[model samples]
Every structure is written in C-alpha cells, then in structure tokens.
Target: MSDAISAASLLMAVVAILYGAWYQEIMHAIKITVPKHDKQINFMVVHNVLVSRCLPLTIMAAIVFLVFLPDVIEILQHALSVLGEMGVKSYRKYDSVRTAFCLVVFVSFIIAMHLCRLTRALMEVRRKLK
Candidate 1:
C-alpha cells in the first residue's frame, strides 16, 4: 500500500511539473492588454510566479510523504496497540504525520488548480480590455 501511494505521488508530481511548465509558457506567449491599475497587474504577476515556484515544493513534499509513510504507519500501529492493551480503544487511527502530509499535498494541488484558473481569468480580462 505504501509503495502504491509512493508511485501515485511521484506520478502526480511529474504531472504537476509538466503542467506548470506548460502554463508558464502559454502565459509568456500572451500579451497583456488589461487596463489595470499598476498594482493589480503587479500583484497578478507576483501571484503567478509564486504559484509556479510552489509547484516544485509541492512535488517534493509529496515525494517525502510517500517515502516516510511506511515507517510512520508502523510507529502509529505500535502506539495504538500499546494503548489498546492499556484499555484505550484504538479506534481507526492513522499516522498523523502521513495524514498531514497527504492533506498538504492535496491542498497544494487544489491551490495549483485555483492559480491556473486565476491566471486564465486575468488573461481573459486582459483580452476583453483590448
């Protein structure tokens, strides 16, 4: 199961990188004509750059999570068993670290999608202004 997760995570990371690259390339190809206040355009450009950079970090975090999941799970299982023996019911518990890591990865992916949408919206606004 850990191995499968690792593989899937790696695949996602690769896809994200490719998508980021393509998105940036397309954005660069377009000419901005939006009659926006300087601040808005600057903010938009900064946000685009930040999102692009975050893609790599997101990928790295996913890979790290996958690599550590097995060990983290083993530790959590042992802790749960010990607690269970002590009369503490080991309700369905998972490794907190693994769960948190996965959540971060998922959130990062969502943010990336949102960033893409925002970029598109900005481009559309720019086109309309021309």
Candidate 2:
C-alpha cells in the first residue's frame, strides 16, 4: 500500500511538471506582434502568472508528500511511543499526521484539477487567437 501510494505521488509530480513546461512553451509560442490592447494583454499575462505559480506549487507539494511525509510520520510515531504505550496517545499522534497528510493530498488534487482546466482554457484561447 505504501509502495502504491509512493508510486502514485511520484507520477502525479512528474505529470504536473510536464504539464507546466508544455503550457509555458505553448504560451511563449503565441507571442505575436499585433498592436496589443492592454486589456487582452493584461488578461493573458495574469493567466500565465497564475498558471505558473500554481503548477510549481502543486509539483512541490506532491514531491514533499512523496518523499518526506512517510518518514516524518514514522519518526513521529516512534517519538510518541516513548511518551506512552501503544494505545490512545500513539493513535492520536498518528491521526494528527494522517490528517495533515490528507489535507496535503486534497490540496494537490484540487490544484491538479485547476491546472487541467487552466490548460484547456489557454489552449482554447490560443486557438481562437490563431
């Protein structure tokens, strides 16, 4: 189960990086010297910035989850065990870590969905402009 979770997390990170790079390249290729209306140009810039920020953050979050969370949780569980025998205290500590892990996972999923939507929107706009 841990192996599967690790694999999935790694895959998600890679996909996020690839999508970000592809989107950036596509946006860059769309640069044409038409007399830019401020509004349209501003919209494009803002969209690009938002996508850039979100993609990297999403990727980073996934990497942290994949590489750090498991080990950290294990260490934490061990530390908590010293405080008391393996019962309520240990379970509570583990539960806290689990909750944090879940939150990170949920956020990553949301960001992934948003990135997908943003990519689609960008592609559509690029098509229309062309």
Candidate 3:
C-alpha cells in the first residue's frame, strides 16, 4: 500500500510539472503577439530606462534581497527609520512578504520585457503606417 501511494504521488508530481511547462509555453507564445493598442504606448523614455538601467538594477536587488531577506529587512528598517518614526509599520511576516515580493519582482520583469518587445513591434508598424 505504501509503495502504491509513493508511486502515485510521484506520478502526480510528474504530471503537474508537465502541465506547468505546457501552460508556460502556451502563455509565452500568446505574449509575443502584438496587439493594436500596444502600438500606442509611448515606449520612448520608459522603455529605454527599463531596458538600460531599471531592469538590471531591479534584477540584482531582487536577488540580493531574496538571498538575504532578514538582513535586507533590518537594513530597510534602519535606513528608513523615519517611516517608523512617522508610525508606519514594518512587515512582521518577513518570510511571507518576501515570497510575495519575489513574485512581484518576477511579474514586473516579465511585463517590462513584454513592453520592450511591443515597443519594437510598434516601431516596425509605424514605418508601414506612414
């Protein structure tokens, strides 16, 4: 019975991983296709900023903060002492917050990259339109 249960669990895990991979691939394909509205977004200043500066800095900061979350929280509390002085509260669930914050970072990066690609597509379409 134990052997059967272990095998079933392993099979379920494999199936879940396969489904996740397939879903990610489908979503990625959908993301790459440009929409009509996306062409209107002025990707001039912000796109350059995200691609050149903000993206790299954000990536590094996310890595550092995730790896040293406790230290990062302590540093932020100390550095932004004024926030505390003003009655702003720090997160008590550091680990939970960190996990959610990491997800936010990941989503932001994905969105930024998509916008960059959309901007490039818009530039191409602009020439054709004119």
Candidate 4:
C-alpha cells in the first residue's frame, strides 16, 4: 500500500511536469497575449502559474505526506488504543488518512473532468479554424 501511494504520487508529479511543459509550449506556439490588468482574466495565466509553480510544490508536499503517513498512523493508533484503555471512547476504526487520500483523488478527478472539457473546446476551435 505504501508502495502504491508512493508510485501514485510519483506518477502525478511526472504527469504534472509533462503537462506543464506541453502547456507552455502550446501557449508559446499560439503567441497569446493577455493584459495583466484585464478586467476579465483568462485561464492561461492562472493555469500557467499553477502548473509552473503550485503543482510541483503540491506534488512534493503530497509525496512527503505519503512517506510519513505510515509512521503518523501508527503513532495515532497507539495513542488511540492507550486512550481507550483509560476508559476514553476512541474511534480508531476509521482511517482518516485513507479518507483524505480518497477525497484528494476524487477532487483531482473532478478537476481533470473540467480540464477535459476545456481541451475538447480547444480542439473544436482548432478544428473549425482548419
């Protein structure tokens, strides 16, 4: 399971880097120019910023979390068991890290859906242009 998590995180990091490079190349090829102060901002700037900077940072953080998750969970479980022994009610049956990980995956899926829509729209426009 830890290996799977590490692999997934590494895969995501690689994909993000590849996509960011592809996006930058496409943007450069198109010669897009958007005013920074424009009232209505387009996704190019936001996407570029996120892909170039935030995505790598987020991926690194997730990788770090994955690396330490086992130790954290073990410590947490031990604490909970000790508390339960002292007559304290403990809900150790739930795996919060797994739940959070699932949520992250789900949210990423939703974001990918949106990106797919955007990609489809771009393809349609390109097709019409040709």
Candidate 5:
C-alpha cells in the first residue's frame, strides 16, 4: 500500500514538474530574461525570477503537507473501524483503510492546489482591474 502511494506520488511529482515547467508564470520566466547586448554574449538574469520560484514553492507546500499525513491516517483508521462497527464489514480490512486514506489525501492535495491557484489568479485579475 505504501509502495503504491510512493509510486503514485513519484508519478505525480514527475507530471507536476513537466506540467508546471510549461505553466503560466514558470514558462514566462524561462522565456524572458534581462536583455544582453546583441553583439556580446553576456549573462542575463531572469526577467521575473519570482515566477520561476513558484514551482519550488508549490513543491515545498506539498512536502509540508506530509506532516499532516499521520493525523489524517489516524482519523481514517478510526472512521474505517467505526464503519465496520456500523455493519460495513468491507471497510474493516487494514489494506482498505490505507488505500482509502491515500485516495483522500491525494484528492485533498489536488483540490487545495487548484483552489490556491484559483485564488491567486483572482487576486491578480483584481489587481489588474484596479
């Protein structure tokens, strides 16, 4: 079960990196750089370096979330046991609890990220409107 979670997490990380690299601010950061003299090949700084940092910030947010996993697991385990007591014998299995926990955490993380992005975008749009 842990192996599956780890595999899925790894796959998600790879996909996130690929997707985020091309995503709004990161893509702009990669393409735009401080202008260097055309005649001389000089080093150029990123145009908006903060935009590039968003990827690392997002990854860090995910890592920070790992701290809560154990608590979530505990709650899920309890819920599973309770469900079993309530006559839902199918959820009583140890593996079932772990799998359900993984699914819940994965979905929660995805939702949180999307909501954050949506909020940031709305704020940006509001600022532009001002």
Candidate 6:
C-alpha cells in the first residue's frame, strides 16, 4: 500500500510539473484567466490556480483512501479499542494517522465537489465556443 501510494505520489508530481507548464492553455480554453491581471491578485484566478495545482495531490490522496480503506478501518477499530481501555491517552498513539485520514477524506470530498463545478464550467465554455 505504501509502495502504491509512493508511486502515485511520484506520478502526480511529474504530472503536476507538466500541468503547470501547460495550464495556461487549459485556462485559455476554459476562459478562466480572462480580463488579465496587472500586479494584482484576482481572487478567482488565484482560486482556480490553487485548485488546479492541488488537484494532483487531492487525486492521489483520494486514490490512497480508496485503496487503503480496509486497512484504515481495521486500524481505526484497533485505535478505538485502545481508546476504550486507555481513555484519552490512546489518542496519542494514533492521533496523527487518524487526523490525517479524516483530513484526506474530507479534502478529497471537497475537491471532488469542486471538480464537478469545474466540469460544468468547462462544458459551458465548450458550448459557448461551439
């Protein structure tokens, strides 16, 4: 699982680099970067760039969650059992992993929803171009 995640991470890194190089073309096609900026930060452009850049990481995290869900569940059960016995002290044992898992799941969901919105926007742009 760790190997798979590592490989995915590497692949995402390469893809992100490539995407960074070519993203302006995509933005042009989707018209997201129109009304160009000049020494000023446009919130919408910033949001889109951030979203696009983070997409690779979010996708890798989501894939990790899907692939390791069973293991995560088993670990979570063990953590809970420890919690029951040791009360609050057990939190220290698994807090980082637990928190990371929760955060990945949450951020993945948000990114997925945002991707849906982006898809709709792309489709709209495509329609306009036609």
In order, candidate lDDTs are 0.54, 0.55, 0.43, 0.50, 0.51, 0.53
For candidate 5, what's the RMSD?
Answer: 10.5
RMSD of each: 9.3, 9.2, 15.4, 10.6, 10.5, 8.2
Residues 1-130 of candidate 2 have per-residue lDDT tens digits of 3554465456556766765666665455344333445446645654564456544654554565555457556655666675577555555444454445455556566656666565565555544544
Off by over 4 Å in 6: 1-5, 32-65, 95-113
Give the C-alpha miss distance for residue 19 in model 3, angstroms: 28
Best by TM-score: 6
The TM-scores of all predictions, comma-separated, are 0.37, 0.39, 0.30, 0.43, 0.37, 0.48
Worst 10 residues of 5 by lDDT: 39-48
Note the residue pairs that clash in candidate 4.
none
> Worst lDDT window (10 residues) for model 2?
29-38
lDDT of 5 at 30: 39
Q: What tens digits encode model 3's per-residue C-alpha lDDT throughout 3-74?
A: 433433344344335434444433333244344565434334334443444344334433433444454355
Q: Write the per-residue lDDT of candidate 1 for residues 38-129, one digit (tens) a residue.
A: 64665565456435543454455445555545655666677667677765454445456565545545654564565556556655644454
The number of the candidate with the highest lDDT is: 2
Q: Name the lDDT value of residue 56 in candidate 3.
A: 46
lDDT of 1: 0.54
TM-score of 6: 0.48
- Listed per model in order, the count of residue pairs whose N, CA or C atoms clash below 3 Å is 0, 0, 0, 0, 0, 0
Candidate 1 segments exceeding 4 Å error: 29-31, 34-97, 122-130
Q: Write the per-residue lDDT of candidate 4 for residues 2-102, one digit (tens) a residue.
A: 55455545655665565565565444423434444541344444445445544454455445455545655665577568677864454545556555454
Lowest summed-lDDT stretch of 10 residues in model 4? 121-130
Tens digits of per-residue lDDT for model 6 on 38-86?
A: 4133444444544564354445445644655565566678878998999
Q: How accurate locally is residue 123 in candidate 4, as Cα lDDT from 0 to 100?
A: 41
Candidate 6 Cα RMSD after full superposition onto the native fold (Å): 8.2
CA displacement after TM-score superposition, residue 40 of candidate 1 (Å): 25
